[model samples]
Target chain A: MTVVTDGQERAGDVRLGRVGRGVRVAVALVGIGLLINGSVRASDDAWPFGPMSQYAMSVPDDASITYTRISAQTDAGTTVDVPLNIEGAGVARAEIEARTGEIVKDPSLLQQVADGWAKKHPDKPKYVKLELIRDTTQLVKGRVVGPPTPAVLATWEVRR
Target chain B: MSARTVATRAANWFTPAIAFARIAWLRTVLYLFVIVDMHAFVRDTRLKGEHPGLYQPLLLARMFDLPKPTVFNTTALYVVLIAACLVGASNYFPRIAGWIVAPAFTWWVLIGMSDGKVDHDHLALVIALWVLPTVKAGRRGRASYNDQARSESAGWVIRCVQICVIATYFLSAIAKLRSAGWALTWPGSAVLTWAIVRRPHPVGEWLLHHPWMLHVMQWVGITAEFLSPVILWLKGRWQLFGALFFLGFHAANTAILLIHFLPTVVCWLAFAPMERIVPWFQRRRASDSDAGEAEDQAEHGREAKEQAGA
Candidate 1:
């Protein structure tokens, strides 16, 4: 009977030891998590934000962005403001494909063009306003390479 | 049974209390009160001026979709979610509130995530919605401490939510290491300056121009996140200081950014034991075990009286 009691006592000690080990493991994991967190906190462009940086930089999906307004000084010299749904960022590098004066129906492809410029000048402006006129679409087909300039705007005939 | 058996049973009974303390420390203090509230401020500050009308629902909808929502079709869904949140805050039919509010909030977050610029605040709401359904916040478990049984079994979900909150900091800290510039500039006025130039609060704007203020904020932010484990776990004056620092941080954020979630703020009130404030409120209210025994004895005494009368 004493032998059986002694074995039981040893088994209980082992179980207690295992429980202690588990708690230690938990504390250690939490510590590692905190250290990692502290290091990552030091970075500027963090995760959730980094993943969506492109989209935030992308033009507003809906036809109209609240803060930005699109006003066109028409050929008649009359300025009419119609909100162009500004989807992406970088005003200088953005290109718009217009079909006979109206913006293109599919804006998804614009993202690809914007992304290409973003790769070259990651920090510089990528927002380019494209005024699509009937004949102008052919003149500026691929990526617009640099920032929006008087020469580029004049070449594209983007008056507004 | 021997005295050892009796002592063991008593110790076993105290397990839940220890667990409760752990949960309260993490859930109420760090995640719910500090980290989550800070994210709310970030989102709120971002959506200012002309952006409120368009951004509020748009951001919420984007939470539902990480990129590209199917369509921003459901206005009714938001209203229901708001209503459920209001009710859940009141702790009425907590289980039901948890179920409805969690899904509705999740739906809104899915919509918010659809946009690339997702606010971290929605993650907190998601975790809260998931856990609120299982907690014994309402009267459901008021009859006995066995209510912990129902809660302990749902441990996986609780841990997941905890993990999510912890990861936000972990990931953020890791990002800090990637660039030397972030270390030198971070925990400084640049964050505040960016806010001031864009959307300046009276106090924030005033403080931004003060070169010393930015330095103070930067150090505080770094030190706070770095010492989070210690500040949150050590119970006493240190815990209170931690809570206050957290409050000040979020309050500053709110002043600068207009996001408001009063429920979350109230939940933080759990940090300081309300027992002292109300004095005898919880005790006078009586523990479930006491109430249960009282009811049982009352029933027995009434039965005896009835039999004697008969």
Candidate 2:
């Protein structure tokens, strides 16, 4: 026998069921916990349970990304720009970004990359000349302010 | 208001609106989106860009020792995820289905996102997706307020999702400010500029010429993120405006930097008074039903009268 005073609350309220209520409270608490934890940790990797530190900082408009491009030559001897299909090799973007960083630090890896490609695809024709280039330009706006001044960092000859 | 009062109000605010119909629609759309996400865009195994050798498990995957999925495993996980999503959507063993989706979706997201960059946007949706099954069931056409059977659970789940949505922006603001330095003004601009260049939008080139615009975007973006939680405290039209503003923010983010936060947008649906639409639809249907019944009775009476006369 329940009497409504201020309010008895709704009957058959599924949220009140012990298990359902417990789950609801637990989930809400856990969500709060994660939100706090994520905020405090403040790293890119922590994710939903962590700080969403994506693009937290700014860089100069002139800040440049050292990108890798392979100019692969066809059987007809026409050279074309080839994107580094890192995912195709089962590598993550972070790993690729790291590798690019490495290339900038030590220019010698460019030859190793070219040779590895030739070994993997012995049948396919490769760029007669693979050049690791530093194309310094105003690349931020997606509109090149000037020609990509290709400063050849390193070069490797691909095996025919 | 004091902290306790605020907490009480939040609790009351989330007190389940009759959510059976509203939740049903959201759940179906969300689960289906997950299925499509796994199959098409983010398929880490057989479909799309898959690199088994390159599957570097992030902190959680490594900590939990989740399977380093091969082609077979990714495919298997995909099938299981699709089944769970379908079952959950259909409301057959919804808890079991939801349970399965949470982990499967986590796994799917981990494998897909880990390949390139791990995104925080889908994280909240994962939390919401799992908790949704804990909500009580309802008739598709019934009004949320009138439902006496298994009340409030639906609202609790929906409220949890709203909280998750808030966290996405609120926490993001905290993270940005915590590291607020020279980079906030500079690197932020550089990042967006680089992104536009990489993904060549029609307006990206136009935007590049105006470097000052980048700075304005940066400050405005962080300010919006910080203030987003205010919507929770606001009432009625203000809440609607707040919600629309955040949606616009996400839209701007996608258009400018090509940063997609689609799942977070889906979770935003929780903030909407979606239950009202269902009741409105039901009223129309009810009126149509009553009219048809009246017409039938009138036809019967006319026939009876004519027969008596004859």
Candidate 3:
């Protein structure tokens, strides 16, 4: 009876020891994992959870991106490339088609863009590049070199 | 211990001011760096381009058609506030610095919030800074980078900072869970496919043309993000695994995506118990810490002797 009791006690101790080792190993693994997880997710790059890619992801397809050139009326009309953002890809395609076609179909738009550019800069005439970053909105940038102050504009449809 | 005794002990030792300063210092530096970068980009880009309108810093503004200066002015105000906060972070003049910085930072962020893109990251920083001004960080200099003097709030301040740091992962995990498609599509493959279809980098575009690579990448991304939270919260070998997963994921993102903010992401590793990072640092620095400390103590002892002789 005494021998049997000693054997049983030894078995119980062994089981407890194994369980303790397993728990320790599991704990160590968890701590290491947490450190790693925190490091990668909290970076400051890619605009650090701001816009850039996020906005780019949201932009819809079928937006127009066009490129055009405008002529300044003041100081002997000089031709320059200008960019504009129209509503849709179809509008951009239509404008391009109209430019190549016999009659100037969208005279009103061309004149409006030209007038807007002319008003923004009084000192020198220049050209602008407008790209559609999103639907219904255009990004316009320009540079004017010397007199004759010509404005050339171009546009392109945004892609999603 | 009894709850009453515990409360009394805590009250006797607790130093709110020092705790506030430590977190304030950490946040102010981080916020300042981000704002400075934004300011530099805006200032430089505006000069080269005709309309300052081309660069929309955040998309929330565009959705509502908010005024142009709405974005610019708000960002500029943060830039100024961050500068003030940095001074506050230095542990100089707590009452004045704390009062001014807390409101200034909050107001600047409020303007950013007025638009749609109220980033959760900025929200975390605001809370950290706001709570700090109420603490005694200014008086004790416990939070100052150069000050080694332990303050009354040091332990509790550290504990709170640790909690805040840990919460970031918790929130990110919740966000991932909310975006169910991430798990369903698998982030690795989905992100790869998305990148390829949209603005494909040279390497990503090449890989996309091969469907096998795209499929593999997709699985990797999903597994990393989804399982990461488990490892992060556990804080041992698990934390190491989590870090490795993040490093791999971020490296892949950096390689493929034109997005440029990985450095700040890696800094979050500071929250890991120093026990783990210490061994790694020890190999590089060897006896540096002991030698430096010994030198400082020796210098202090000499100063004391000179005073005695005088």
By DockQ, the best candidate is 2
- Candidate 2 retains true contacts at a fraction of 0.44
User: Model 2, range B168-200, lDDT digits (tens) per residue?
Assistant: 888777766666551344324565666665556
Q: Per-residue CA lDDT of candidate 1, range A80-131, in tens?
A: 4322222222121111312111234433333433343344446754334332
- Candidates in order: C-alpha RMSD to true structure: 15.1, 8.7, 15.4
**lDDT (Cα, tens digit) per residue for candidate 3, span B48-86:** 122332223333334445444444655555556666656
lDDT, residue A147, candidate 1: 23
Between candidates 2 and 3, name the one with more favorable DockQ: 2
Docking quality level of the chain pair in candidate 3: incorrect
lDDT of 1 by residue, B1-310 (tens): 6776664433222111211222332332322332233244332222122122222234333344432322333445545655665554444454675687666555544433322244444343355456546444413322221111122312323334434443433344434434434443354324444433334358765664463665576566556645554542345566677667767766766775443334334444434432132213333444444787556545433322221100
Q: Candidate 2, DockQ to 2 decimals?
A: 0.33
Best by lDDT: 2
Which DockQ-derived CAPRI band holds candidate 1? incorrect
Give the interface RMSD values of the models in order. Answer: 17.2, 11.1, 19.9
Looking at model 1 chain B, report the run of 10 residues with the lowest lDDT sum.
B13-22
Runs of candidate 1 exceeding 4 Å displacement? A1-160, B1-73, B79-93, B136-138, B141-173, B179-184, B256-310
Q: Worst ten-residue run, lDDT, model 1 chain A?
A: A52-61
In angstroms, the error of model 1 at B296 is 19
Model 2 bad stretches (over 4 Å): A1-23, A68-70, A83-95, A101-134, A138-145, A149-160, B1-18, B45-50, B136-150, B181-191, B285-310
Query: Could you tell me every candidate's TM-score relative to the true structure?
Result: 0.47, 0.76, 0.47
Ranking by DockQ: 2, 1, 3
